[model samples]
Target: MSETLGRRGFLSAGIAAAISAQFAATHNEARAIEPIERNGQAKFKYSLAAYSYRGLLQGKAAELTMHDFVSDCARMGLEGTELTSYYFPADVTPEYLRDLKRHCFRLGLDVSGTAVGNDFGHADPQKLREQIEHVKHWVDNAAILGAPVIRIFAGHVPKGGSADDTHRQMVAAIDECC
Candidate 1:
C-alpha cells in the first residue's frame, strides 16, 4: 500500500510538471504575438519639404535654388528635407547628384526622400508603363541622392476603368518598379 501511494504521488508530480512547462511555453508565445502599435507618440527627426518652395522651384517669384533650400533647412534646425524631383534639372548627372549629397552632408542635413508624380491608374497600357518607368527612374535618382525613400502617387482612375482593376494595375506596376 505504501509503494502504491508513492507511485501515485510521483505520477501526479510528473503530470503537473509537464502541464506547467506547456503553459509556460504557451504564455511566452502569446506575449510574442501581441500586436504592436506603431502610431503612438514617437520622437522622429524633423524634416522640411522642398515642395514648399514651389514658386522658387518653378522659377516664378523666388529664385531659391536646391542648395539654398538645404541651407535654409540647416538654418531652421531641420535634420533633413525632401528633394522633390520636379525642381531638378532634366539633365541631372551622376556628378551633380554626388555633389548635392556632399553639400547636404556638409550642411549636416540629409536628403530624407524624393517625391515624383506618377499615374498608375491610366487605362492605356502604354501610359501605365511609361508612368512605371518614370517611377523607376526616380527610384534610381533617389538612391543616387542618398535618399532613403521615394514617395509615389497613383492618380485617379480613368473614366472607363473599374476601381478594382485600377487598383490591381497600380499594385502590379509598383511591383514591377520595385
Candidate 2:
C-alpha cells in the first residue's frame, strides 16, 4: 500500500481515481483492454504518465517505486503506464528492467513506454551526437521493457542559433538515431 502518498500525491491520485470512476460509470460495458483481437472493434486504452506521480515516485514520498506506480494504474483500471526514464535508477540493469515488465504483466498493465528529455537542438555537433546516443540507449531500454512507444522531447533552439539551423541539427540527429 502507498504510504499516505503525501498530501499532494494523495489528492492527485484521488482526483485521477474519481475521473476513472466517472469514465467507468459511463462505459459500464467496456471490455477489458488486454488480449486484443485483430478482428474486434478498435478501442482506446488509457495510460497514466509516471511523471504525473513524480511526487510519490521520487519526492519526499520516495518510498513509492515503479511497481507501486503500475499497481495504482491497475487499480484505476488503466490499460497501460508510461515509465518515464528520468525516474529509473542511475545504474539501471537488465534484471531491473525484466522485473518491471514482469510486474506490469502480473498486474495486467502494459509498460506503454518510457520517455527521455533530449536536446537534439544542441548547437554543437558533439553535443548533438551525445543527445542522439542518449536517445538510442533509451530505445534499447524501451525494447527490453517491451514498450511500443517512447516519447522523446526535442529541445528548444539554443541561444543565438537560428531556428532553421536548429531544426536541421535536430532532424539529422533523429535520422541518426533512427
Candidate 3:
C-alpha cells in the first residue's frame, strides 16, 4: 500500500509539472505577440493623410505648408504621407513637386501617395469630363512628386439621377482616368 501511494504521488507531480511548463511557454508566446516596432514579421506601414489636417491646411488663414505637414509626420514617426492635392499652391510647378520629394527623402519618409477630390458620378458630360481631368492632373502631379498612388472618391448620385446611372457614370469616368 505504501508503494502504491508513492507511485500515485509521483504521477500527480509529473502531470502538474508538465502543465506548469506548458502554461509558462504559452504565456511567453502571448507576450511575443504584442506588436513590436520594426519587427520583420510586422506587415503594416503607417502613413498620415494630409486631409487629416485640412483645417490647418486650407484657406487664406491656413498656417501649415505641406513641408510643415511632412515635418509633423516625421516627428510622429510616420513611415509615409499622403499629400492631398487641395493643399498644394495653385501655382505649383514641377520644381515645387521635385523639391517636396527631396524634402521627404531627406526626412526619411516616402510620399506614399496623393489624393484629389473628384466626383466621378457627375450626370453632365462636361462635369464628368472635368472630374476625369482633375484626377488625371493629380496623377501627373503624383508622378512628379514620386508618389505611387492617388486616392479618388466616387461621387454621390446627382439629384434626379438613378443609382444605376451614377454607378455607370462613375465607372466610365474611372475608365477615362485610367
How many residue pairs clash (N, CA or C atoms closer than 3 angstroms) in each of the candidate models, in the order given? 0, 0, 0
- lDDT-superior candidate, 2 or 3: 3
Q: lDDT tens digits, residues 39-115, model 1?
A: 87887899988999888777645588788888899999999999998888777887888888999999999899999
The candidates, ranked best first by TM-score, are 3, 1, 2
What is the C-alpha lDDT profile of model 2 across 1-178, one tens digit per residue? 3666687798999999999999998787575466656887779999999999888777545867888888999999999999998878868888999999999999999888899978888877788888899899999999999999988887889899899988887787888877
Model 3 lDDT vs. the true structure? Answer: 0.91
Under the 3 Å rule for N, CA and C atoms, how many clashes does model 1 have?
0
Tens-place lDDT per residue, model 3, 120-157, is: 87777898888898899888999999898888999999
After superposition, candidate 1 runs with Cα above 4 Å error: 1-43, 59-62
Overall local distance difference test of candidate 2: 0.87
Q: Which prediction has more favorable TM-score, 2 or 3?
A: 3
lDDT by candidate, in order shown:
0.89, 0.87, 0.91
Give all TM-scores, in the order shown: 0.75, 0.73, 0.75
Residue 133 local lDDT, model 3 = 88
Greater TM-score among 1 and 2 belongs to 1
- The count of residue-pair clashes in candidate 3 stands at 0
lDDT, ranked from best to worst: 3, 1, 2
